[model samples]
Target: MRRAPIIAVVLALAVPSLARADIQPHKAIYDLVDEDGAATGGRVEYEILGNACDGWAVLQKIDIPKAGARVVTTNASWEAADGSAMRFHETTERDGQTVSRFRGQAASGSNGFAVFTDGEGGESFGQLPQGTLLPTLQTKTLLTQAKRDRSVLSSNKVFLGTSSEGALPLEITSVLSPRASTPGDHPELDGQPSWNVTSSFYEAGGRPDTGPDYTVRSIQFGNGVVQSMEITREGATARARLRSLDLYEVVECNR
Candidate 1:
């Protein structure tokens, strides 16, 4: 699917976060592999938005394949709210794809974060049941809890319509912190990847909620182009080979 034009404009806005963290240059294609060294066949498209000085950030488009004719697609926007702040918004498309099955918004504040969404496609991450009280409580209650402790953890869970079999859930997790840095591979970046990044959800604990490990490493390419990366997932018992990368200019948006 083609990226929305609105994203094009957002991509061009330069901000401080983009420059502070030695993030890679914008616009690239990345592949997601499973533990067996086989491509999970999941594809991620990313682009840096704006100039590095403004508040550089990355936007990702994810497409997941299903068993038969069904395909799950998510358009995610990750913005560096400054050197220390980041926020995310995701819209999901499933089955036919024309109609929006689910839509959600999540933002992080100094203390913690909250997510809110109302849609039919609850099966995708972040999308929830209509008027679910716990989510609403999390929005108001969790915020204060985070502020009191100053350490917080939050994630998005999408619950599709229920069937006789049971409820199907999809999840997306994020770790927010005051001192998180960029991935270690890109030390030049102003910000480092958040420390102690762990993602998980309850089962009936199924495989759908688990994600592959990613470790980025810097590798020298014969060409002038430079990049770093690694993939390490305990479940997959696979390691991402040292691969070449291209670091692009990140644009920051003026808030």
Candidate 2:
């Protein structure tokens, strides 16, 4: 059900420094389940590292087990610094055997962003429209725009990097409230601003009312940490809740 792109739906800021100034470097673990509260035999582990000067590195791994002796695992790593250049790699495996893999890079060009991929025999490469953004940059932009406008709705086009398909249009709606107002397992996040965000990913230029190809709902911290998330497609829903969090020391950038 078009699950590859769903792995890139994590939240990140524009650059490391911007994120460091607001968000903290951290490692998070989440447990996955279904609507019936039954264990889906899925787990997710995410780590964000580095700073704006050295660039930001994001690593994510997800494992979902099926009824039989088969299990699907998706691993993705993304690195970007200053929005000028980006490198991404995603690999999906079934029952411990590689099923699909994508390795690519994108950079700013004179006209727009140029994407180069070595996937499927090095045939997937193209130029994105001028305003197109890589996933990490897009996330950063979304957070910046949301705070600037102080509104709940924002839209942008993001290059998935996994495929030759140009870009995916995204509409994000957020609800901001005090973290202390709600009750949850992570008391360390209390008193900070929290956001309940819903993001719809669709084909570029697709009408917003036409329904989204995929939708993800996440409860995220003001500093960009996602405490929990749920993804839905074709009436099937999967949920991920934070299990543990480790905040790293922030590097002080000399002004």
In lDDT terms, which candidate is top?
2
- All candidates' TM-scores? 0.41, 0.82
What tens-digit string does per-residue lDDT give for candidate 2 at 126-188? 566566666556666656655565445666566655442433323443333233447664876
Q: Please give the lDDT score at residue 172 for candidate 2.
A: 40
- lDDT (Cα, tens digit) per residue for candidate 1, span 93-118: 65666444333333333333234333
* Model 2, TM vs. native: 0.82
Clash count in backbone of candidate 2: 2
> What lDDT would candidate 1 get against the real structure?
0.34
Give candidates' CA RMSD values in order: 11.4, 3.3
Kindly give the stretch of ten consecutive residues in candidate 2 with the minimal lDDT sum.
Answer: 11-20
Which TM-score value belongs to model 1? 0.41
